[model samples]
Target: MPRVSQAHLDARRQQIVDAARARFASHGFAHTSMADIIAESGLSNGAIYRYFTSKEQIVIAVCEQGTEALPKALTPEAVAGFLEYVRARARENRHAQLVAQIYAEAAVSPPLAAVVQRQLAAMRAAVAELVPESRRADAAAIAEAFVALCASYSQQLAIRGDLDPAPFTAALMAIIRE
Candidate 1:
């Protein structure tokens, strides 16, 4: 057999992750199985196993792919737009529900918790970097609150469905301007 290119391998891996993400979002994590993922990916069992050793590994991969990087220049308008974008994506993909599920699972799974913590830490750092120099001393705390509020907004959308981002955005702007 001819050797597959690196890009091909990466695409295959991403395909598996995408399939797993869809399944996990539709069905809770505890309810999803490796067989479900394999079927969802339209790949054989061996093909799925080639990329991920187990379902847990796939779960971590999906979590690692969570939300895009925060914008470099954070502004109130930017934050509002970001929240609206996230809400729209959540409605389309049910990813916000999946994130809630991941948080629940992380509460009981140490390895998953570690991955989540690392991701949160990175997001907080990114948000902190966008803070004004005058707030540098409190950037860490500001980032924590900002990240937490954003997360809460996502969760609210997941549970409540189609809420006005106006209120959430207003709260976020308050944090950003404070």
Candidate 2:
């Protein structure tokens, strides 16, 4: 057996994470198994475990990726940009469904719930920094409102197949500006 170099190991870990994202986005965190990830990534069991201890860890990583990957600024222009991003992602379908599934799972799963809450708090803190000084006190509230609006938009897209986001974003910004 040959030894894998540090760089090779990091690259392999990234491969596993990428595979997990696709698997979780398609099959969902609950239904996706380690073997499914193994098949998706073409990585051995040991290689997979070398990067993550369990499915929950992989899921947390995916959720972190999703949260951290979102645009940070909350300005009107940024909001519009994010709306477009969300709309485009909605068109993709799979990843949006997976995110919704993760939200549902987080509601019942205590461990996952913690991960979700933690990531949301981090997102709020980041947004808080970007918020104007006058709005600092409302940063957490604004963050909550922003998350709720996006979730609602995602649900609407899933249920109604309607992609129009302008009205929703406008209304949300109005509320935030109040």
Candidate 3:
């Protein structure tokens, strides 16, 4: 019997996820099939299925990829860093087209809707922590506004291939300063 290390398992899973992300980004969630991902990964059905049973699960993983670009802390500096990160991604047209695709699909998919709701809540909580205690009542709304703005910026990149971002950055800083 051979013992496979945990790192090996993680790497294998990530390999599948990376392939799924590329396929989904290039062709979108609705258009990309599991077979496409399997082919893209150059792995067999059993190998890819061993990691993700369905294309929806793989889409969720792709959604999870962008979460890291969000701020880890509630500090103003971290928020600024997050804005810059979005700006950089927008300039690149971003790997996050998959995220926008998820949003579009979430309207019809309950599982995806729930995933998005959970992530949005997590983001709101993180942003709320940055506000003063007395003003926290508006934190959730502000967080949603920030997310929506970022989403629009990301979507624009898909068409234009570049976003000026100065206006969006000013608006994001205003949200934080408020």
Candidate 4:
């Protein structure tokens, strides 16, 4: 057997993360298992463990990835890009269910809760940067409200299967502008 380089190892780890995302999104955190990740990733159990110690760690990684990827989906020019992405995703019925599921699981899982908090903080920081110093405090409050609104809207769409993001976005923009 040959030794794999750090790059190969990193790639393998990313593959595991990607597989975990799909499994967690589909089956949820509690239902998803190490075996499930291994099966989905097509990597042996031993190889999988080499990258991550446990399923919980994988969940954290996925959440972290989501947090990092989200900002890239939006531009600084458009302060509401994140909201628009959420609205479009809601309409497509993708990612919203997964987000809701993770949010539910985070309520019970301490590690997940911490990860979610950190992600939220990062998002708030990004939003805060877009505002002038004089209005930073107000901007932070508005960002919090925007997050709460999106979470509520996502939950509604998930449960009721009725998504009307236009009105919500309009109202949110009005509030931000004011």
Candidate 5:
């Protein structure tokens, strides 16, 4: 058999992750099974298992792949734009729904919770770095609130359907600017 290139291997792994993401987004993680992921990816069971030994590992991969969209600097306009960008992606792919589901799953699953806490800590650290010198004293608190607000927005988007991000952005800015 011809040796598969690393790129090909990565692509196949991504394909599995993508399928699992879609399934988990549409059907809660608990509801989505390995069989469902296999069917969704149109790949054999062996192929899926080859990349991820279990659904939990695939869930970890999806969580690890989440994008960090924090603004480069702390500013009202940048924050608003970030919120809008999140809303757009949520509408396009229902990724917000997936995140909301992950949050729920993390409540009961210790491993998932650990992965989520790590990601949240990283995001908070990144956001804290963007705090203005004047607000440096409150950077940690602000970062915590900022990250929470962002996750809240995702939860809102998932539960409330498409919403005007302006209000959510306004709320976030209030906490940020305060």
Candidate 6:
């Protein structure tokens, strides 16, 4: 038998995660089964189990994939790039619904809820870093505005089918201009 490189292993795992994301998005988490993931992934039971122990484990990976490492500052150019990233993901993988599904599942699952809470805390910390020293008095408010801006886009994107990033990018740029 030949050995597989780490990149190949990671890619294989990502394939499973991508398939699971689509399945969980189209069909709610509770309704999505390992068999469904297997069919969606076109991978056998052994292959799937080799990567994730259960649906819960895969869901955790889904959450991990959804979360990005927030930069110290979210500048206008960065917001433009962010919108482009979201647009491409939505066009190719139904990214918005997958994220919505993750939140939906978290509401009912404690472990998933913890994962979400931790992610949100990390996000807040990152947003805080974007606040200028001069705005220290209003740092909390400023960070909250950024958080709300992100939440607004996320919620709207999940529901809107227009696939237009113009408005989103504009709004995000407006924040950066502030």
Q: Evaluated with lDDT, which candidate comes out highest?
A: 5
Question: TM-score winner among the candidates?
Answer: 5
TM-score of each: 0.94, 0.82, 0.83, 0.81, 0.95, 0.79
Candidate 2 Cα lDDT to native: 0.77
Question: Please, what is the whole-model Cα lDDT of each candidate in the order they appear?
Answer: 0.87, 0.77, 0.75, 0.74, 0.88, 0.77
Q: Candidate 3 on 1-178: residue-level lDDT in tens?
A: 9989999999989999988877887888878898999999998999998888999888877777657457665455665677667667645545657667888888888888888888877876776666657557787777788777767776776666666666776787677567
The sequence of per-residue lDDT tens digits that candidate 1 reaches over residues 56-84 is 89999999888554655667678878888
* Candidate 2, run of 10 with poorest lDDT: 65-74
Q: Is candidate 3 or candidate 5 better by lDDT?
A: 5
User: Candidate 5, after superposition: displacement of residue 113 in Å?
Assistant: 1.3
lDDT of 5 by residue, 115-178 (tens): 8999999999999999888889999999999999888888888998887777877887787777
Model 2 Cα lDDT, one tens digit per residue, 43-155: 89998998899988887777766763455666777877887787787677455676787788888878888888888777666766766677778978877777777778876
Model 4, range 54-93, lDDT digits (tens) per residue?
8888887877776523333223335356556766765653
Off by over 4 Å in 5: none
Query: Candidate 2: lDDT of 46?
Result: 92
lDDT of 1: 0.87
TM-score-based ranking: 5, 1, 3, 2, 4, 6
Go through the candidates in order and give the C-alpha RMSD of each one to the true structure: 1.3, 2.6, 2.7, 3.3, 1.2, 3.1
By lDDT, the candidates rank as 5, 1, 6, 2, 3, 4
What stretches of model 2 exceed 4 Å from their correct place? 1-3, 68-73, 133-137, 158-162
Find the 10 residues in a row with the least total lDDT in model 1. Answer: 67-76
Kindly indicate the candidate among 2 and 3 with the higher lDDT. Answer: 2
The collision pairs in model 3 are: none
Comparison by TM-score, 1 against 3, better one? 1
Each prediction's total of clashing residue pairs, residues at least 3 apart in sequence or on different chains, is 0, 0, 0, 0, 0, 0
- Whole-model lDDT, candidate 5? 0.88
